[model samples]
Target chain A: MADTDSSQRVQEILTQATEELKSIKVPNDDQLEYDLGNLLVSNNNTLDETLTRDPEKIDSYLHNLARDSIQALLNRVWELPSERIDSDIYATLPKPTTRLPREKPVPKPRPPTKWEKYAREKGINNRKKDKKVWDDVLKRWVPRFGYRKIAAEKEKNWVKEVPSNADPFEDQFAKAAEMKKENVAKNEFQRLRNIAKNKKIKVPSVGVTGNEYASKNELSMAMHHAKHATASRGKFQPELPNEKKVKGLGKKRKIEFTTGSGQVEKKRNIEVLEKMDKPSLNLDGAIHKEIRDENVAMDLKRKGGKVYGRRSKMGGRHRTKSDHKSLKLGTGFQGKGKGKGKGKGKPKGKPNVGAKKKIGGPKMQGKGRPAGKGKMKGKGKGK
Target chain B: MRPLKNEETVLVFTKLKKYIGSNVRALLERSDGLYCFRLHNGRIYYVKEDIMKFAATLPRDNIVSLGVCFGKITKGGKFLLHITALDFLHPYCQNKIWIKESAEQNFMYGNHVYKSGLSRISENTPKYAGVVVLSSKDIPLGFGVAAKATAECRHADPMDIICFHQADIGEYVRNEEALI
Candidate 1:
């Protein structure tokens, strides 16, 4: 029993020596500063010469110093707050005192749109409106815009009273609907214009003023052309401040030349070739001829001159018997009045028909008369 | 290398279609992989998609050429088919003309094939249609447009032109500087 008691005392003494060795003690203990929130501790206390100088004891001594620092930090963290997260106890960390450098600079504010600028100038504060509004007729809330909204109210009416100035047969309902459509289109156009203005894109002119030569558009266009006249195509030219990216204002057209998968290109090529292969006749000459004929007819009527006859303008000669008789009588009278007039004019009037029929072969057979064999023979005998 | 512009694509495709007819589509999209046409220094290269993507990363100056050089677009906007395109053209050519052994050297000299040199012509070959000119042993020497229809060739004089020479393999040496 005495031996066992003695062995227990020896074991207790060994454990006490090890415990003493594990506990680190440094001079000026209060000088050690720590930030528990950052889990950092700064130990400015002088190190013990015995532990640091001995290579074998250096690791354990340094480890004991770290453990003591960590324990103090944990104890300070535990005193602050505790929370249950996902059924696990967690000590809430305080806000870090250290100011870290930013990864990127603060972003610039977005430029105001045209409408926003206008609103600001007018001292208008934007207020959010409710999406749904109460409808009296339906007795239920409906959206302000889109999806069962009370839009185009005028068009929704089944019957509309026409004004006295309006035609009685006119569809007033359709007219109302068209007006509403025009209004919507105008609003949409204005919205798009505002967006384009904000984006620095030049809007197309609504109309050309009479004094366009002196207009801003003309000046800008001239300047644009002059700038592009350079060898570098205005690339090296000096730029004006606050310049809007208007198309044709020293900007080359961004041609999205269809890159070759070759499908679209092939289709386009085939279409072009097909169009080229197709026989497209130009009927402009024919149309001009008709216009000319109409103008000539109108001129003759205006002058109070009788129209010679119904002339076939499309090359087909559609002469009546009366026309031929008139021609023959007029030519015969003219020939008697002027000696060689009949010889020149008679053939012009009759040869096309008479020569084709082979009836008026010889001048002695007939002159300025219809080509008939029996009539010609009888006329010859009588002569 | 960059994807060909519409005009350049159309120009290349049209020239390719002249020889292969509608089979130009087969060249565009093949069973092996999707192939695309790219333009590099006026030369149109028919490259596979993956190789094209890889080549795109390379500096333009470093790359001499890629894939098959089908042809080049001249400054005058005319597409000139190179003899390098003969490999793709021979398989899909719609019509073919074969010449006799004695006149093979004459054709190589870039002269138009005469009726006396014509050994066998493809049946129903249309007049002015693109045809592959082959030797008597069935080797494609070059390509050209048929000067006369198959039916008109029977009565044509020996001195009469049978095939108008467009391009020949002999151009590889003679017109070496101009070729890609």
Candidate 2:
């Protein structure tokens, strides 16, 4: 009785949504930003709209609603950036008025195909490479990045000495990774449990252990078989019904395209219709190719070879006890053999099989007759 | 190529029943959807409609077959959303953004939300949620993909691109329905 159900799950989602809505409705500066939906929920506890009788509540609500129109004035900005915005925290919203260009991409110079004999005359030799400049201007000093330079500058004795302290904490990424592993395990367990419940089957213990690779092989084989079966079914599925459906849905469209000469105009889709019937429609005749493979598989099996085939355990969807019926239903495969001894028309005593059951109300017989006098019988019982 | 395994089908069914209402039979309602189910290489694939051929080239087993997405494949693949799922979940989803009547008219003609065309947005629309585009009367005008977080959108002007209109399943769809 205490187990969780669909309704309870829905309730949980509703509660979560309500909590989120509460965040939006947090009464900014004592002004209630209540919409008409909120009014109904607060007063009537339903989505049904009704007239508000309380003048004070109405006044406050109207005032807040008017303030929402201030969002209009908020949109009128003096200076805003044209570039795409990635984020906007409440404390520091990005605005072109105050924003400075953060990065300018440096153009990378490609090496020349051939150095000119008069390169010095062409002013190409005026530029000094970073290595040359470093050796000439700054001796015994390696180039440091922006942050490293700042750190080195701050390491002087003139600065105030701060007390050394340390608080150890795992990186957020590492913490999240650990938590995510647990979450993955929990979710997998839940999925397995659900599958077991649905199929009314018992689940094995949580670990597959050594059977993992074998299971993978089996799963892939099943997938291949299923894929082939789908291809065949789709290729052979009746297209006539869909053609009729198209014609039926376009009765008015046909009328709209009537020629002035009173002759019916063929739709432009005739070419498409022809193309669909062609081998090009079925993935360039992959369906027939798969069918050939299946036939080959059948022949190989008939030759008593223990080779990889469609009927093998790895291939095809794993059929359950119930699905086994679908594999054999009404095909007269085994059902034909059952009725061999008996006549074809009808069975001996089974009334429902043929025209043997007597229809309508039962006939009154001599021994089955009841006594007349319904009014007297009721009065007698009452007395 | 093969029918779905009992374990696989049952697992997917349970998920659909939870995320969608129990009334939707999903795989059970149609024998076609059930019989053609594929559990290939650990991934589940069922074609209700559209381009499901991508299942053949699926990279891994992490997918839950939402349905067949016909268009662009992302870094993850077409974000799985079955038509049945879309239809069943249309109302409850908080990611749908409704536009004004004027914008709705132009939206079907290939113009998305211009300035002064916004009407309403559904609840707690999170970052990168697939959004259903709705007209003023709340009829679906295909779908949109949110490009930014809420805080970004809140600070953005009406002219800014908050969502990228993806598929156009609107009045324009009527002409193609009969042809195919």
CAPRI band for model 1: incorrect
Q: What TM-score, over all chains together, does every model reach? A: 0.39, 0.22
Worst 10 residues of 1 chain B by lDDT: B25-34
Task: Write candidate 2's Cα lDDT for A173-287 as tens digits.
Answer: 4555689798999778766656565566744432352235445444444434344476564465444333322122234522221112111111222232334335645574787
Candidate models: Cα lDDT each: 0.70, 0.42
Each model's TM-score for chain A is 0.29, 0.12
Poorest stretch of ten by lDDT in candidate 1 chain A: A374-383
Candidate 2, B-chain TM:
0.52
- Please estimate how well model 2 matches the true structure, expressed as its whole-model Cα lDDT: 0.42
Which candidate gets the maximum lDDT versus the true structure?
1
> In model 2, what is the error at residue A171, expressed in angstroms?
83
- Per-candidate chain B TM: 0.92, 0.52
Whose DockQ is greatest here? 1
Error of 2 at A369 (Å): 99
